[model samples]
Target: MILFFGTRPGKPETKKLFHSICPYCQQQGALTAFTVKNYFHIFWIKLFKISSHTTIECSHCKRGFYDNEFTEEMKNELSK
Candidate 1:
């Protein structure tokens, strides 16, 4: 039996972080949040969502920040 089950990532939803500053570029309002959902797929068909990940990126410096690297302001804004 051939099993074609795997996980795939969904389209990332992005939102600009207002009043958020990027630590790498030191630029204000340059932070953007990206939320991506992973789903389990079988035979190229999506079955169920596995998990989701949130990442922050700096448009000025193009630096990526993970969950543990998020700043206080970033967390506050993302929560809303």
Candidate 2:
């Protein structure tokens, strides 16, 4: 029998935060936050989620940032 167990990244889910500012773009740009998760899979089927990260993107500039870049206040406001 062949055993198949490994970790893989799941599909990213994004939510837009309205009326946001982009420091890089220096404009009133729409901010979108997304979640990416790594999951344990067996036989190509995801068994369980191992780790997850939330990140933000600028709609106008199309830049991405790590979770640490944004404050908890920003996350709390935009994550919902």
Candidate 3:
């Protein structure tokens, strides 16, 4: 018998941060928050969610920041 199991990234969810500003671009409302869920799969079928992560990106400058690099204002707006 053979088994196929692995982890895969789920669909990405996006939200615009109205009150957040991009430090690099200095553009308000340009910050968009993206969240994705990682899932464990067995035989090409999703079994369970392993973890989730957040990423902040600037539409104007096309810069991306990880969760750990989030600023205070960015964190506040995302929490709400």
Using lDDT as the measure, which candidate wins? 3
lDDT of 1 at 73: 87
lDDT of 2 by residue, 1-80 (tens): 99998999999987777656766685564678888899999999999999998888888888877877885556667745
Residue 11 error, candidate 2, Å: 1.1
Candidate 3 has a TM-score of 0.83
Q: Where does candidate 1 stray beyond 4 Å?
A: 1-4
Top candidate on TM-score is 3
Candidates' lDDT values, in order? Answer: 0.93, 0.79, 0.94
Q: In angstroms, how far off is 51's CA in candidate 2?
A: 0.6
* Ranking of models by TM-score: 3, 1, 2
Per residue, candidate 1 scores C-alpha lDDT tens digits across 1-80 of 99899999989999999798898888999899999999999998999999999999888899999999998989999999
Ranking by lDDT: 3, 1, 2
